[model samples]
Target: MSFPKYPEYKDSGVEWLGEVPAHWGVKQLKYLVTCLDGQRIPLNGVERYSKQGSVPYWGANKIMDYVDEAIFDEELVLLGEDGAPFFDVGKPVAFHSSGPVWPNNHIHVLRPGDSAWVKSIVYGLNATNYIDFVEGSTRDKLTQSRMMSIPLAWPPHDERNHIDSFLDHETARIDALVEEQQRLIELLKEKRQAVISHAVTKGLDPDVPMKDSGVEWLGEVPAHWNVVKFKYLIAEFEQGWSPQCDGDQAETLDEWGVLKVGCVNYGVFDPTENKRLPDNLEPRPELSIRKDDLLISRANTRDLVGSAAHVPMDYPKLMASDKIFVVRLHQRICRSRYAVVYLFGKGVRHQIELQATGASSSMLNIGQGAIRELWIPLPPDSEQDRIVHELEKREADFAALEQETVRHMRILNERRSALISAAVTGKIDVRGWQADQQSRQSEILMAAETRATYG
Candidate 1:
């Protein structure tokens, strides 16, 4: 294909592309693309999966189901039309493929003159923060007018094809690496859970005989340990203050209050996201969290409801949310960390789930009455300390590995986006590329063969 030659310019905010050939046109997103609102297929109709026949139906979240027909089979650029997912510089959006390719109003499907050209634009959009302008509560909605007004950089057909092919290969490679790292992270998390579950329930020395702790949840513990109720060990189990009162009660120190259900501690004790209570509001002494105090979520998603965190003394004074159950242990009876870990452990979580109310929405309200009655297997003080020490050391090592993996994942993501940004913006030219094309074709063929044989 013949291409046009042009002059270069300065201070264009196109640093990633260095200098764009002047002949290449710059147009508003509206000029280069049209937002073809996706046809909405009923969720029920799409629920049935047809293996041999049917078009793939897409939903805002992903592929909701498969239908027998596709509305637009030709490839297109799909943007999530709805939801509150954080889609910025490195967060890749998953688009749906198949029959009508229906995207919720929460999603917008872009039809381009050339599919290859649009892929380049999509990559650019993904790499740069593309939709920072669209704002709303719940899911951010995109207005067609506003979307068209966004800026777009376009290159000639040949140059666009070259950039698309290069990015198609490089970004996939980076994504594969990121996926591998994510899998490793999942494995580490599983191992962490296993280690915690084993240590707390069985103790370090497995040679000890196992005996039932009477409490069904405490199925088995060290033969020498005593099964005691939680109430017998803690000074008090206080519920959170009701903020619905006075409307002002819900008001935080700042505009929003601290101690909302969302602010409750999960894996870590985070006080930053708390709502601010009114300045003149009297602080509830009962809600005050002390160092090593185990705060457990009393109500939330089922899996996360029983999650707990050990409050560090250095943390500023913050009250527990209504959805959280703050465990003020009698330091004289049990070491706080041990209790925190025990309550947060999978074993205890299962018990909490069994006793918790609310089927559609799981609620973990182990009031002082119920919490006091809940049974715990208590090993001798020395044994508890020993187990805690060994577990803490292993946990620390696991946490360090997790942090390292996360850091590397971040670097890989940054590299992947940079690679796409570079390829799309003409920072690194990939024009008339032959060898890479052959290599990529070979790789795709090999992948197809592998999938056919194994998957």
Candidate 2:
């Protein structure tokens, strides 16, 4: 395919050059964009409007979806004005004022001003990474002042359009590749989880005699296994400490006294993402997590409500969330590792659902009372340990695979961002670019192969 060509450069009065076209101008964002025109509604007024008006309301959470109504009906970009994933900008963020709700205080609406070209303005804002300007020690928040103060590199109107169209096409291609990688990661995760769940719940020997374990989700276990409730093997189950308005947490610790949610997986107490609390702190008697304890999440989104993790010998003193259940196993009754794997398996999770009750607003919980009554299948100690050890090895392999996938994902993300930044800054010339023209095709192919094989 033939590519478009631009006129030769004649030192068109610009300073930054290597690949920048000579005619482009460097300008401030304030000159090109204007805040949406309207009387900013009060917070309570906006809420009432959402209830009573006929417009679509736009907020940070609603960026990916459309609402019933908006305050206005123009093509505009909405930016986050507050907490949680704070100061993020929504790109391709056009919203037609065709619904019942309007933009809220948590969103700042921006429109291209007379001096600005809309497409270029959006791309410029995007290339500038204005979202990073939102400031806060916590997640980060954006103020209107910060929103209007970002810098922009400007080109002549016609040049701006050319740059915008070029960027739109190129960036879309990169985004498509990134999206493909994300989908692959998801599939890998599902497959990995399936492998782990199967090996842990059922022994490696497919020839073992099977029988119904009484629980429907559990399907069948070895004929010699006994079906019993998890509560029967535990000494006790209960909540940890209650942090009132004042709790003695002044600094974060690593060597560990208490295990926060980050340390232990709330439901199954998987220590994969564990963080340590300072050893100087006093350990709460009830909350102290011991080796072989099964921790379950009491509260979370409905799907993750009963997700669990097994605490291993290496890390024992972890305390989980008030939302987690810690099951202490009786040595003579069941093997802790096997019990942990069993509780985290599909069947036990299905059983926990029966005990869970609550409104649509939030899922109610199942605590020690409900946990103690849960029936589980008990296998002989030797068989159980053997099954657990095999499952552990498989789990380790899965974890390693997951980590490698994440590393590739991070690298791809960085490269994708860098590609956009470089191209937009005019660090490389692509004026005669063709879809088949690739400067680093070999490196990209190598990365793709590695990702496909090990990712």
Candidate 3:
């Protein structure tokens, strides 16, 4: 949908905002709003908890955590002072927070002197590009004085409320649809996981006689299958060495690189996660990744501690880091591709969780003993090969569907951002525009129904 431009425009004397409706007024942000800088609490002072509290602790980004208490109890807007980038339209830099928010020093809390300006200020800040006003090298910082000096485009108070109401309704609808698409993607992922779990744990022969696998996650297997400790199938397994190197430099094509833990985190090989080796260091050639090699993450969050992936491509000079382990398997005993599926499957995942050792608050690590000792229900090599082939074929269609759903979600989010920016910036007048949009939507729905009936 397109919006007509406002009639009779005048120069606003601001470069970013070229022109505005003739009747609109321009004011510096400082004069139009009240800055409550004194009300902020430091992050360390703000007690953090996991879903155990009532009050929201608003930081530079979304609610960083929920605490036991509230510092302020009224509705206000919070803009990032640093840490959060303003260029991202998807995650807005300004937040319209309400009801018992404990704001931190990383953001500026503001209340409009006129209650009517509340939503307008939020919309403007979110739409405005703020790279000009921020300071600091690592993280951009928006200083209080710079924020106060910024010019804001202001319309009539009543018109401000009208624009606010229009955006609130439209963005909410767009957000709900985006949420639906997101839920669909999650469902697709779960379906993909189920396919892998079934094919790897239970062979393609459903009518075959079954026996107890003795593993809780793998309840039953084909009668001929045997459950054995992982050590029996592995020739050897060991974590790789790490050499000190600056991580930000470009990687040389044929030089040594140390793989980060994320390479196997998502059940795929992500070669881009490696760091370039320093010229002074020499890496052992035995550690270099070869075609058909298997790798697993030794240290990660407990949920992903034992994640494994098969390397389908060979690399010249890449070796694993200490956080990841290279697996040398006896192929006669177990198929490599089958091993990938079983390690990431539901039942074996639980075993990995049980074996992972670390303080509850930190990253979990699985020892060589645990990886070797964990039991697996195995089929013969030929059956393993068949299972892998069937799963890959079944997942191909679901993966395509998931990719398409993700593209649709991205388009919806882009539309949401464009709609909000247009309504707030007076590029379009939204007063009573809600009813017009509703009518147009009804017409489109009616047209679709009429087409379906005729065909």
In terms of lDDT, the best-performing candidate is 3
lDDT of each: 0.62, 0.56, 0.77
Tens digit per residue, CA lDDT, model 2, 216-250: 76678778778787666888676654333123332
Q: For candidate 1, lDDT tens digit of each residue in 1-455? A: 11112335333344323444454555566666666774544444324432224455555546554555555766677666556243654566534232255444556777766565667667655644445546666557656676666555567877777767766775677678778889999998778877877877788887999998777655788898888888878876666664532233333233434455555444667666565565577767657667777776777766776667777783334677677777778775677677867766777767777766653332334444546666777877777788778988988999899899998778777666655655454444456544344454234323222111211
lDDT of 3 by residue, 338-380 (tens): 8898887776787788888764323778888878887888899
lDDT, candidate 1, equals 0.62
Off by over 4 Å in 2: 1-20, 36-74, 82-107, 114-119, 129-134, 244-259, 266-283, 313-320, 350-370, 373-375, 434-455
Q: Rank the candidates by TM-score, best first.
A: 3, 2, 1
Q: Which window of 10 residues has the lowest lDDT sum in candidate 1? A: 446-455
RMSD of each: 8.3, 6.8, 5.5
Show model 3 residue runs off by greater than 4 Å. 1-3, 32-60, 63-73, 81-85, 101-116, 134-150, 241-244, 280-287, 301-303, 354-370, 434-455
The predicted structure with the larger lDDT, 1 or 2, is 1
Best by TM-score: 3
